[model samples]
Target: MKKLLISLTAAGILAGCSASDSGNGQEGPPETEVKTEEDPVTTDYLQERFYEGMDYDAYAVEIQTWVDKGQASISDTVKIEGQEDVSADIIQVADGFLAVANDSKEITFIKPFASPEDAKEYLKKNL
Candidate 1:
């Protein structure tokens, strides 16, 4: 019984000595942390490059639109050449006779000049 009591006391002392007491130290509430701002990504981002590139016919139409809004001096016809003859809708003031179609999908907007004279051009241009 005496050995058992001494053994228990020694074990308790050993356990107490092994346990750390620093967790209760006076460490004035955790320091107020200031979160740093995250920097923006430099790459790996898709963008509107095609939209940024204003095609010539699109530009002409935009100019005509601006002209039509207030002034009538701009003589740009804003013609749009599509797969079918949609002159009425395309040549008018609103859609600038413009549209995003399957042809633009296969090729960029610079496939060919939007001019009806594309067939008669002297530079061997494709109609």
Candidate 2:
């Protein structure tokens, strides 16, 4: 009868609107976009007391000048007495060497002696 036909039509409509039928005709759940972030660069001072409040960029340029002038050479690492071996760029000055951290660009240690023998003597007396 008319009621039976209407019931069938309604059932057909309900079936069409079921959750399984995505309007886009795709199967399963929709994919979401994922975003990733990078780690931030950090700068720190190892010996803050020796920091003369100079601009880091200027200081770097000055260090580069020393390298250019053959007054200093960059080394991969420096070993400090009574301290852990540090990964740094060693700068040789007239008096001693300056241990600069590679990542932080901070002066980690300042030795006011020209040679290893002088450094040993100084460390023996001081520490």
Candidate 3:
């Protein structure tokens, strides 16, 4: 009985010493935390690439505003190059006009317009 008690005591001591020694009296490597920023939802995301010397950021802001205020709704149909009439809403942004479908599924950029009027005329003829 005494030997068994001593063996248990030694086992307990060894276990406690090993656990304490594993700490090494020092801190571990600092934990790494990752953070991420979500991109704003807007039709401007469809812009493939920015044209040189174009103020695309301002244009993106305008597009975002139009979307937020529900100003992007237009009841008109525009003819696709070869497909049937597609009902699309139009918005004029810097350097061009964007035709966004009712479902917000498609966006077409018509460029070379000095103003919204010019884009309207182009739409009239094209559709």
Candidate 4:
């Protein structure tokens, strides 16, 4: 504000002394044009088009099946909580019937399989 007042004061003083072209004096620098901001357009797009999907289920099932085969080398040590470690024995049982541990008692039938939908269906049919 002080600089502006000094500039206007200098402009006023300079205007009185500057040489006149046709006895009508015009002095000081030309007026600068004030700039205004434009209404900006949004540039983001909803979707990108440069990607592809690959099936992982085939690989997963193949690996699981390979591991399930009896030809796979068996490991020596199997860990269990509060019990002696025993070699993992893949015992076959009826569908939707799984054997899970219950403390030191013999492995008993754990009601409700891993899949709730399958368990519900089994219960509907059997129970």
Candidate 5:
């Protein structure tokens, strides 16, 4: 009975130690990999097409804010409260304004510029 008890106690201790051991052979909490806001994972898709070094998220947020306020609208022609008339329905992209219209049954990719002003100017002059 004494030998059986000793064996059981030894097994329990070993099991407990292994359960708490960090895979590095050290006993304690496992190491965790931490990331910061500047990390690529944190930025996600915003990494592409930055404006004045700002991420796409910030730019998109600004545009969406305007849209929510009824300051911006996208349709056959984009109408911004304070900006000039846009030639076609404009979708804000990381790079610039993209003309979008549902009338055409074809897919089209408008070349994006680097600034919102450029998009507005393009619309004013071209469309």
Candidate 6:
């Protein structure tokens, strides 16, 4: 009789401990983190289009003008290859903008002499 009682008590303790160890007493599958991979072509396009050197203020004004005209829109973030995702002031012209102004707020415009169609082709290939 004593052994039966002791076994029952041990089982109860084990059950309680196991339940507490599991999260919040909630019965459901464990939570998982979802990671989305950035497209390499898009990353390359952003890096190639917007770089360290270029006229930011001029581009900003031009882009803002386009935005006012409803020809463009300013967006929030872009994922660049070889760099962490950055919050940038992105001007979308036509299919996409030729530059971006990053966190430093310095905008980098399109490669000096590249045509808009060239930029568009570069982005359109894998997009």
Highest TM-score model number? 2
What TM-score, computed on C-alpha atoms, does each candidate reach?
0.17, 0.33, 0.29, 0.16, 0.26, 0.31
Instruction: Indicate the worst ten consecutive residues by lDDT in candidate 4.
Output: 42-51
Summarize candidate 5's per-residue lDDT along 46-123 as a digit string, tens digits. Answer: 223222323333444544554564443342344544334222345543323554322123222243545556666765
Tens digits of per-residue lDDT, candidate 2, 1-127, equal 9999999999989988884576657543222212122321111221322343333444566556545655555543444445453334445544355545422444433444345455544544543
Winner by lDDT between candidate 6 and candidate 4 = 6
Candidate 3 residue pairs in clash (backbone atoms < 3 Å): none
- In model 1, how many backbone clashes occur? 1
Which candidate do you rate higher for lDDT, 3 or 5? Answer: 3
Off by over 4 Å in 6: 1-51, 77-86, 97-99, 103-105, 108-127
lDDT of 3 by residue, 1-127 (tens): 9999999999999999988878578543222222122433223532433222324333345445544654443323454554454434455433345554322233334333344566556765664
Q: List the residue pairs that clash in candidate 5.
A: none
lDDT by residue (33-126, candidate 6, tens digit) is 2212332223344444345644455445544554565555654334444445332454444434443534334553333113445443443342
In order, the Cα lDDT scores of the candidates are 0.31, 0.45, 0.46, 0.30, 0.43, 0.46
- For all candidates, the clash counts are 1, 0, 0, 0, 0, 0
Candidate 4 structure, TM-score to reference: 0.16
**What lDDT is obtained when candidate 2 is compared to the true structure?**
0.45
Q: What is the model-wide C-alpha lDDT for candidate 3? A: 0.46
Candidate 3 residues lying further than 4 Å off, grouped into runs, are 1-46, 49-66, 69-85, 94-105
Model 6: how far is 60 from its true place, Å? 1.5
Residue 57 error for model 6, in Å? 1.9
Candidate 6 at residue 18, lDDT?
A: 85
Q: Ranking by TM-score, best first?
A: 2, 6, 3, 5, 1, 4
lDDT of 2 at 42: 12
Error of 2 at 116 (Å): 6.9
